[model samples]
Target: MSKKPVKKQDPETTGHSWDGIEEFNNPLPRWWLWTLYACIIWGIGYSIAYPAWPLINGATRGVLGYSTRAEVAEDIAYFKAANADLREELVAADLSEVANNPELLHFANANGRAVFATWCSQCHGSGAAGAVGFPNLLDNDWLWGGEIEEINETVTVGVRNETNDDARYSEMPAFGDILEEEEIAQVTEFVLSLSDDDVDQTMALAGATVFADNCAACHGEEGLGDKSQGAPNLADAIWLYGGDRETIMQTVTNSRFGVMPAWNARLSESDIRAVAIYVHGLGGGE
Candidate 1:
């Protein structure tokens, strides 16, 4: 028998499907919807209070004026203020006076030691043991005099700064300029001989006159260098420049210059005094 024709269904109301699946028209949970809305609101608030967006010229500055550098500067100023009185007292007192006062000297030395560790330690080394080009602070050799006043002056004005009136200025003329190369060699040998406990008497006898006429001006008549010019004493074993024959030849030919830095503006008076005391205490102090 023929089946009755299937009734036509309207597309809007039809629940027909090719697969075994059904569709439903439903709304999302109210809490979920509200949570999304809250996120957007919070983002906008954050942008306003904090640096969030990029501009053509620069990034936006946050409402709170916080900066890393400003904090550091403030900390430094606070520390400086805390030490102002001590710094003032140190500046007023003479170096000798500072040395005499045990309390002040101790304070000065503590400060100076720290400063020395930072600045002087690089060349002079820790404990002022010295290096290839640097002088040993523990020894009796004072290239420019070891007296406290002398050391203070050396630290203040320096050894070679032309601008400084009190700079320890001494120049050893190159004998090679006036003397023959053989004479320069002879004097160099003689200088070396002077430092040696067992030197050739014959060679030294010949070189003595050469030393007197050409070298005596800076390196005293006895080969003991003039400290006023930072000239190292040859009579002793310590040599600021060097003690080798080749080194002496070079010094004789080209001349030698030793430089000490000026610390007047950088360091305080008490600090320098402390350094002088510390240096003096190091076995070599007079």
Candidate 2:
């Protein structure tokens, strides 16, 4: 066999050891060094092109002078242009006229339906069947009024709020303070009897006396609610508060007041009209 020589190791790190292991200093990879340099150059270019510098008044206007708000406005303008005819048709047509015109009605209803879902659906249900304190928009019985113009007014100016100047306002006094429990019970029975013909005639007769004295001034002798007073007709099955005996008792004890929010500030005129039309189309269009 021929003899072979062993290669010698470098001596600068010969004495350095970590549990008998030695370390070597290596230069960074060429690709990594270039990548770092490229990042620094890209940052400088980006800062120059965009509004990166902050001043006392605002940010600097870059060479492009582009703005996010301007871009948004341009986008909105484009969308409006594309849908101009539909918007115009809705704006020009009276809500009742729109209902008669199938195409315009469709356009208005679609937009109005969407807005109602966003704003009004929370109080008035998705189906427009209102809750305990809210009147059902789907029903013909209207407290404030159900005409398209009236609905539009309600939409523009909400009820019982300082912000709404012409807000619908009415209040029924709490009879609990004035009337005895027996008297309240009699009134509750009377209110229910107005709807049900099958009610106990004897009890109803007795309740009628109480109704004549306490309720006839607001709710007519026939139980036809006074719109001017915002008193709902007791003869109808549609109860704003509720129809149950317990709920009716509660209403008689302590009157209820419902509120509808103003959509004028939150929505455009066209949008408010659209919702009124859609709600009218829901079956309460008067």
Candidate 3:
């Protein structure tokens, strides 16, 4: 039997070539071209119908007059109007009495958690455990007083922040240039001895005198710390930074200044009260 002749087919190429390799001048599929053209038209229409161009002040409010911010504002206004009575009640009610009202308490806690997550969770952990330099809210140890009123005040005015004139203010003098190296060491040793039994006995003994002379005003003679001045109790072993000897020395040498913004500037009174109530109920409240 004789085999049939084979047919050969070749596509045209563009006049472009690289290293003797010809470029195929293939037309895009008809469906793809139509889709591309449709998209280009849709894009142009969308640009005219919505915000697309950027200006120095803001983006253009396109023909459709659509604004995401305006929508959000409307939604917020609706919610605020709906909850106005409850929020007013929350603001008016005493902090201690907030828990007694079931409806008020529920509203406050839910709102408070949201507020805390948005504002407080940045420094304090999601669980309010706190980070280094930040105070842990879950523990009974408090840099300032942990009472609901105190928490309200602290949240309202903030701590060590220059923005609020009435901010909870305290400054621990950096003892690096103030104290002699040996005195610093002795004081650090004494600070350690307040929490730990195992320390250099001689250094600790000398440190007691040094502590009395220098740190006793804020830290107390017994090293129990003064809450009025935001001084931490050294005897409790609860450290804002770390309890290590070197860390303590560094802290004494260069004092720590933690700043919290006055929430009153950003949040309403009701929101602040809600937050105070939420924090108080977090098991660390006095």
Candidate 4:
């Protein structure tokens, strides 16, 4: 049998050329053209059905009202609802006695770690060994009280924050304006002498008098610090900002005002209690 002869059409080209290479004016394949059209139609449909257009404040809520955040919220709500009974029991139970109940202790430890990792880990590290400005939760050196009740209250209300009405509040006088530079330096020396074995004996002696007159009212005469006034113990080697002579001088001059957010505004009562229990048991609490 004889095969039919193939037709040879002249090649088409656009007016564009680069050296000897001519631009072929070829049409896209039929399947490829159809796929492109389908994609365009799908994109339009998707935009209409879901949030796509950007607005001044936020994205447009599409006709379907599909929101990833909303879905996530719903999922969270479902899980929260599932744990409602345990949470209610936790909230009702006294935090001091939380460890007595194995179920409650187990639940608190498990959930508290999760909550701490999510919220507390940013400031306090994942291991709860805080950064320069942040206090280490693992240590016994707490600015505020370290009892289970105290921890719960601190976590709930926070320290030096404006949001919570019952927040732990204290103000260290900016000695830069109040005292002379030499006085500030002397007091800083005395403060250093509390923890550091090597200190200027003469300057520290002079600072003893200055500390009794100005700082003793809050920091105490012995430099052990007043927990009632939220004053940190300077007698110990654990320093919040730093233990260096330069850092001590700066602290004495300017004063440190660290702010912590009130978890009560963001977290549930049970969650706060759980975290408090978790922190208290971390070999730090009194």
Candidate 5:
């Protein structure tokens, strides 16, 4: 018997055609269709179980009650609980006692650095070096005393702040109104001489009498500054405003009155102590 050739079957069409090309009416595979349906069902189930829809006032609260904010709050609570003991000890202990304990000191310094970056870096530079008007914490110069107790007091009460009754207060008279331009120039030269900067000896000599009569009550006779009066030392090269002749003239003529806010009302007692320790350890504290 001879082998017969197999006949080819024609594929079905959609009864539509364009320019002699016919459209095929092919059915999708059953497995692929089922998979697509399964995905749709899963998406619907997820929408019902969790927050999905948005309303005018807020978002949907699904049956599962899942919330990102609640989870974050729980994490914060856990962290605070874990560090409660150390935080409590830091709050209760004296600043010196905190410094004596190596572990506590380390913790305070680390926290203080973070606090300084957040709160103080705006005025004092990130390095605590300070700017033109701000006082540098890294040097030995201090308008107020630099001891831990003193630093704490200054930070708590602040300088020239009206809100705090115990704030460090001082007033520099604007000599532009009191004295003539010639007298102001004489005093500027005298201020420069205190720092051992080269100046006209004759002018400085004349200003020495003027200084003794007017400025010595606040600035010591030697220009070493009186911490009690919050007067800055004129003898030191460190100038809060500037060391140049023009700047000195300006200071003498107009005077300088800078203000620092009291931190006691803004920060907790523990936070104030920590910052004091951090500032004191910056190689300047007495």
Candidate 6:
């Protein structure tokens, strides 16, 4: 049998053509088209099953009533439930006992660190190194005693806070108005001598008399501060303000009164105890 020649069929093209190029009108591949259709269906199903549409007051309550907020609440509830016993034990345990139990100590430290970072990092540095006019937690120096109970007490009832009646309160008399400028300078040199810093021998000798008359009652005769009076030890290099001559002069002339907020009303009892432990364990607690 003789074979006939096959004819070539031209592909359909749009009317527009540019520079010998033409656009072919081709149908999408079956697989690709089906995939796109499936995606659209999935999107519609999702819109119906979850919160997707926005309304006037709030969002839509989808068929499944799924909510991100509800999910988060559930997760929070689960977390609290898991940690409830441990937290209760921490709350019930004595402040001293917290450190004795390994698990309790670990939990308290972690929570206390988080709490410190959130609440205390602003005044105390992120590392709790402290700043000018702020007491450093890393050192053994403490205006109040550094015992765990004392620390807890100080934290509960802060220094110079007005809200708490039993707050640790102390005031340095502003000697700028009380004494002559020369007298202030003399006392500054005397204070500097307490730390064995180089100072004017004659003026410090004279200032000793002035210190005995005015400052000895609060700051001991040796300048070893009284914890009962909340007076800072002047014999050490750890100065809350500055240790320089000028700074000492300013302190003597104007006096420094700093305030720390009472956390008793602000934080839970367990939280306060935890922070006290955390601060005490920072290599400074007595």
Q: What is the TM-score of each predicted model, taking all chains together?
A: 0.70, 0.70, 0.93, 0.85, 0.75, 0.76
TM-score of 4: 0.85
Model 3 over residues 1-286: C-alpha lDDT tens digits?
Answer: 9999888756689988999999888889999999999999999999999999999999888999999999999998999999999999998888888778999999999889989999999999999999899889988887779999999999999998989999998999999989998999999999999889999999999999989999999989898888889888999988999999999999999999889999999999989998999998999869
Clashing pairs in 6: none
Which residue pairs overlap in candidate 1's backbone?
none
Which portions of model 4 show Cα errors greater than 4 Å?
A: 1-10, 18-21
Clashes of each: 0, 0, 0, 0, 0, 0
Estimate, for each residue in 1-286, the C-alpha lDDT of model 1 and write its tens digit. Answer: 9999999763452365658755543456999999989999998877777777899996666676655667899996896688777767877777666767787777777777877787788888998989876889887788778776676677778877666777778777776678888787777778878778566667677788898987787778998888766667887877666787788788889887767777776776656765765666567646
Residue 275 alpha-carbon offset, candidate 5, angstroms: 0.9
Q: Model 2, range 22-111, lDDT digits (tens) per residue?
A: 966556799999999999999888878877889999997777887888999999799778878888778777666676788778878888
Please report, as a residue range, the 10-residue window in candidate 3 with the lowest summed lDDT: 5-14
- lDDT per model, in order? 0.75, 0.82, 0.92, 0.90, 0.88, 0.89
Against the true structure, candidate 6 reaches a TM-score of 0.76
As for model 6, its CA RMSD to the true structure in angstroms is: 5.7
> CA RMSD for every model?
10.9, 5.9, 1.9, 3.6, 6.7, 5.7
Q: What shift in Å separates residue 251 of candidate 5 from its native position after superposition?
A: 1.2
Q: Write the per-residue lDDT of candidate 5 for residues 108-129, one digit (tens) a residue.
A: 8877787788888899899999
Using lDDT, give the best candidate's number: 3
* lDDT per residue (tens digit) for residues 175-252 in model 6: 998889998889888988988758898999999988999999999999999998899898887799999989988898
Tens digit of per-residue lDDT, candidate 4, span 193-262: 9988799989998998889888998988899998889998889988899989999888888999999999
Identify the superior model by lDDT, candidate 5 or candidate 6.
6
Between candidates 3 and 4, name the one with more favorable lDDT.
3
